[model samples]
Target chain A: MLPSSTSDKVFRSTLFVLGGSYVLLVVLLLVADLAYSSWGQLAELLGKPEIVHAIWLTLGTCTAAAVLSMLVAVPLGFVLARYRFRLKWLVDALVEIPVVLPPLVVGLSLLILFHLPVNGVKLEDWLRSNLGWSVTYAVPAVVLAQFAVAGAFAVRTMRVTFDQIHPRAELVALTLGCSQAQAFWRVALPQAWRGMIAAFTIAWARSLGEFGPILVFAGATRMRTEVLSTTVFLELSVGNLESAVAVSLLMVAVALVVLLVLRGLGVERRA
Target chain B: MIELKNISIVSGSFALRDVSLSLQHGEYVALMGRTGQGKTTILEAIAGLRMVTSGDILMDGRNVTRLAPAERGVGYVPQDLALFPTMTVRENVGFALKVRGVAKAERDARVHDVAEWLGISRLLDRRVTMLSGGEAQRTALGRALSFKPKVLLLDEPFSALDDETRQEMHALMVSVRTHTGVTVLHVTHNRAEATALADRVIQLEAGAIQ
Candidate 1:
C-alpha cells in the first residue's frame, strides 16, 4: 500500500508541466500585445473625457443588461430545471442560442429588424413615439443588443446552478409552512447564491466587451452611445492608434480586476 | 396521520407499481431498501416533488394528492441534509416562520426555542458550512420542526456521519420525537438506524413494500 511514490511523482510533474505551459502561452500573448503599444499613448487616452464617457457608458449599459437578464433568467432557469413540460427542449435550446450564434450575425439581425418599416413608419420612430424608447443610435439599442446575447448566457448558467442545488431543500421548506416563493428565496436562493453571482459576472463581462452588436445596431457615434469597444473602433478609423490601444488596455485592466473580485467571492470557479 | 392509497409511478428507468402505505398518528416508521429500489422516489412523490402516476395521499383524513407541497404539511430532510451554506444557523431555523410573514419578534422567539430544543443554541451564528455532520443534521431537523409540521420525512438522515455522530443523531432524533410528537417517516439503507428509531419498518424491493 505504501508503494508507487515514484509513479505518483511523475504523474504530478506531468500535470504541473501541462498547466504551466497553458498559463505561459496566454501570459506571453498578453505581454507581447502590451509591449507593442507605447505607455505614453495608453496614458494619454486614459485621461480623455470622451474615453471616460465611453467607459461609463459601457459599464452602465452592461450593468443594466446583466441585472435585467438575471431578473428574467433566474426564475426562468428554476422553472426549466424543476419542471418537466412539453417543448422543454425547445426552451432549453433557446436559452443556449447565443452560445453558438455568431455575435456579428446577431448584431446585423437586430439592426435590420429595428431599422425596418413596420406597417408604415420605421421601427426607430415607433420605438421613440410609441414605446418611448429612442432606441436607434442610443443607449437603449446598445443595451438591447447586449441583453439579447447576455440573457441567453445567464439563463443557461442559472439553469445549471439550479440543477446543482438539491430539490429536497425546497421540499423541506415547503413542508415547514413556507410558500413556494418563500422556500425559493430562503432556501434555494441562499444555497445557490455563489452560482448567481458567477452568472451575473459572466453576463456583465460579456456585455461590457460587446463590440459587433454595438457597432452594427447601436452605431459608433462619438460621445453619444459610444462605449469602450465602440470608442476603440472610432479611434482606429481616425488613425488614432494610441487612443485605441489605450482604451483596449483600460478595458483589459477593468476585466482583470473584475475577474479577481469574482474569484475572491468564490463564484468564479464553483459557479 | 398520513396514508398512501395505490400509489404508482414510472419514470424512464425506475417504476413503482401499486405501492400502498400508511403511517399512524405520532408514529415513527423507517423505509428500508437496497439501491435502485425507488425508496427516495416514494418519499418524493409524497412530498409533491414527483408526480404520482396514480395515487391518493391523505393527510389527517383529507385527500391531498393534488395539493402543492406547501399545502401538504409534510416536512422533509433529504439524504444530503442540504443546508443553505451561505446563511447563519438563526436564518436557517427562522426561514419557514419568516416566509409565513411571522413577526420578526415571534420568529426570533421560535428560532431561539427550536435552537435550544435541538441543543444548537450556541451554533446560532455559525455558517452551515462550518458545522459538523451531526450539527448540520440537527440544524436541518430544527428547520423541519420549526414550523411544527404534521409529518417529518427524513431520507437516509444519518448515512453521512461517523459512528459516534450517528449515535448522537439517533439520540437527538429520539429526543425530538419525544418532545414534539411529530410523526417521523425515515428512509435508510443502514439497518441499525431503522432498528434504533423505527416503531415499524417497511422493507421495499423493486419499489413495492414488502
Candidate 2:
C-alpha cells in the first residue's frame, strides 16, 4: 500500500515461495527417503549379493561410460567451440538429439540400430557370430546406453568450458613454435583441465542416474547387468520399497559427492 | 624483414582492407590505431592467426601467407599478455622450446636465461595468475623472445599498465629490441608509447595503413 499494490513483504514472500518450493521439495524427497529406510535395513540390503553386485556394477559401468563420454566429448567440444563450418547448426542439434529424446526410445533405437542390416549383416548378430560377444541384454549395452545420453551432457559441458576460454592464448602458443596439436595439448587442454574434471563428474553423475535406456537396451538381468538405478527398479517392482529407497539414497550420496568435487573445481564460477 | 603486401582481413565487424606495411630487419616500428580499427587484426594477419582475403605476407622474402603460425616462427604477445595461466613463469617462458622438443637441460637453461634477461628469474617458479601487471608483461615478453624468433609482434602491450609501469615497460621494450635485434611490430593507439619505443611509426586510419 505504501507505493505499490503488492507490498515489499508480499513480493519477497512470493519470490521465495516460487524458488524455495523446488528446494523444499528436493529436501522433502531426500528426507522421506532417509526416513523410510532404517540404517540396519540399508545395511541388510547392502549385505545382499545382488545389491552388492549392483553397487560395484553401477560404479564400474558409470565410470566407464563417463570416461567414454569424455573421450568423445573433449575433441567434439574443442572443434565445435573453435571452428566455423558447413552444416554446423545441424551438427550441433544432432549432438543434442539424445538429450532431448525420450530416454526409453533412445534405448529402443540402439536396440534396432544393432539389428539393422548393414552389408547384409545385423551388427548384434555379427558381433555374436564373429566376436563371440553379445551386446544386447549384456554389460556393454548398459555402458553404451549410458554413454549415449551422458555423452551429450558431457559434450555440452565441455563446449561451454571451451567457450569460456579466450583463443588468444592458443594463438600466442602457435606463434611460439607450437603446432596446433601441441598448442591444444600444452596450452588449451591444461587450461581446460578443471572444466574437464567438472565435465567428467557431470557425465558420471548423469550416467549413474540413467535408467530408461539401460532397462530397454540392456534388459535387467539380475547379477550380470543390474546397475544401481536398475537395482532400485527391481527392488520396487517386487514391493521392496525400503531397498529401493536405500539404493536411491546411495545414488544421491554418490552424485552429491561428485557434484561437490565439481564445485571444488570452480569451473562454473569462472565461466 | 616482415612485409604485408596489400593484405585485406575481415574479422567479425572489423575489416582491415588493403593495408600494407613493412618492417625491415632490426626495425622497431609502431602501428598506431584506435580500438576496433583492426589494429590487433593486422598483428594477427602477420602472425598467421587470421586469414588474408587478398595479397601476401613475406618474412625475409619468403612468402608466408599460406604458412601455419608455427611454421612462421612469429613471436606474438597479445594485449592481454595471454600467458598460459595454468603454468608457472618458467614453464610459460620455455613453452616454445619444449614443444620444439628441445632437450630438458637446454630448455631449462634457455628459460633461465630468458627469465634473467627479462628480470623475471626470481618469478620463474610463481604462477602467472599471481603476477602483477608489470611482472606479467615481463613474463610475456620473456616467453615471446625465448625461441629467438625473427620478428616480435606486440598488441597494446602497455595499454593496461599505469603511467609509471608503462614507462618502465617502454624502457624494457627498447632494451629488448637492442639486445635481440628482432624486427618489432608494436601495435598501440597510445602516442606516448610510439614516441618512446618506435624507430618509425606507421599510422592505421579507418582500416587502412597510412
Candidate 3:
C-alpha cells in the first residue's frame, strides 16, 4: 500500500528539513563573517601596504599553482578515465590522498620530502648546490605546496569531466585519420574546455585558501611569501581581530565572485 | 576489398569467435543481428577501434589488424553518428584533411565538394549541435568520405531518424555508394533497413556469422 497522507507529509517535510539545515548553516556562516567585519575595518585593512602586497602574492601564487595543476591534471585525468593499466588502483588511491589527508600533514610531508636524503645528499641541498636554488621555505615552495594538494582536486574534477564524455567521438576521429594525440586535441579537448575552466577555478580557489602547507613549507616571511591566508594568520596572532576578520571577509568576497562568474558561464550545470 | 579472416574478439563476457567476413571493393553490404549480437563489435573491429584476439583485418588486400585506427584507412560513423560537437559542419567535414596538414585552400575545396555531395552545403557553417537528425547524418557522412578512405563503416545509421528522414537517408546512401565507389559495411538489426540499403545482407548470431 502507498504511504498514508500524514506519513507522506511528514516524509516530505523531513527531506526539506535535512536539506535546508545544510543551506542554513552555510548562510549563517556567511552572515556571521559579514557581521563580524565592518566596511570601515575592511577599508582600514586594505590600506595597509603589507596587506596589498599579500593580495598580489596570493593572486600570483594561486594562478601559478592552478596553471601547474592543469598541466599535470588534464593528462593524468584522461589516462585514469580512459585507459587501463597495471597499478591503476594505486595511482587512483594516491590522487585522493591530498583531498582526505589533514592539510597540515601535507605541509609536513613536503618538508620531509625536501629534507629526505637521496644518494647520500639532501634534495634541498642538492638543488641549492647544483641549480643555485632551494625549494624549502621559498616562494617556489609555496607554489609546490599548493599544487601538491590542489592538483589532486583538479585531477578528480577532470576525471569526472572526461568520464561524462563519450569515447566514440574520439574513436571516430581516429578513424578519420587523426592520430591519438590529434583526436584528443580535436575531439576530447575541445569538449572538455568547460571542465578545464571549472578545474582551474577550483584549483585557484583551493590554492587561495591554502595555509597549513604554505606555512610549514614556505614560512610566513613578511614581504617574501606572505599570502592572504598568512596575512590572516599574522593579524590574528597579534590579537588584531578586526584585520583578521576583515581578511576573512575579503577572501569570502573573492570566492563568492568566482562562484558567481562560474554560474554565469553555466558550467556548474555540468561540472 | 575489406576482409576479416577468422578473427576472434573478447570483450568482457561477450566474444566474437572465429568470425570471418568479406566485402568486395565498391560493394554495399548490410550486417544484421539481434540486440545482443556483435554487429557493432564487427564494425569497430574493421575500423580498428577494437582489437581482435586472433585474425587479420585487411583493406585493399593489406593486413591492418596490427595497425592503429588512423593507419587502417577506414571511415566509421558510429550508431550515435559521433560528430565532433565542438566543431562546425565545415570543420568536422574537413577535419581529416586538416589533420594531415592539407593546405587550407585544398581543404576548403574538398570540404565544399563533400558537403555539396551530401546536400549539406547550406549547413557547413552551422554548429554540429544545431543540426537536425538528417542534417547531422549527412554532415557525419561528409566527414567520413572527405578523406576518400578505402572503406566506410556505418553502425545503426538510421536508428535515430524518423521514418521520413530514414527514407531520405536511404536515397543518400545509394548516392554515396555510387559517387564514392567506396566499400560500405552498414550494421543494423532492422531487416527493412538492410533491404533498403544493401546489395548483400549478412546475419550474425551471438557473434558468429550466419
Highest DockQ scorer: 3
**lDDT tens string, model 2, A47-150?**
99998898888889999999999999999999999999999999899999999999999999999999999989999998999999999999999999999999
* lDDT comparing candidate 2 with the true structure: 0.90
The TM-score of predicted model 1 comes to 0.88
Q: Write out the backbone clash pairs for model 1.
A: none
Give lDDT: candidate 1, residue A144.
88
Given the true complex, what DockQ would model 3 score?
A: 0.84
**Candidate 1 chain A least-lDDT 10 residues:** A262-271
For model 1 chain B, give the 10-residue run with minimal summed lDDT: B78-87
- State which docking tier applies to candidate 1: medium
Superior by DockQ: candidate 1 or candidate 2: 2
Off by over 4 Å in 1: A1-18, A29-39, A118-122, A261-271, B190-192, B205-207
Q: What residue runs in model 2 are displaced by over 4 Å at the alpha carbon?
A: A1-21, A257-271, B11-14
Which candidate number would show the highest TM-score if scored against the true structure?
Answer: 3
Give the CAPRI class of candidate 3: high
Writing each residue's lDDT as its tens digit, candidate 3 over B1-210 gives 988899999989988899999889898999988897888888988888888899898888899998998888888888899899888999999999998899999999999999887999998899899999999999989999999987999999889899999999999999988898999999987888898889899899867888
lDDT tens string, model 3, A1-271? 5657988989988999999999999999889889988999998888988888888888889989999999999999999999999999999999999999988999999999999998889989999999999788888999998999999999999999999999989999999888889889889998998888889889989999999999999999888889899999998999998788899888888777866786667555443
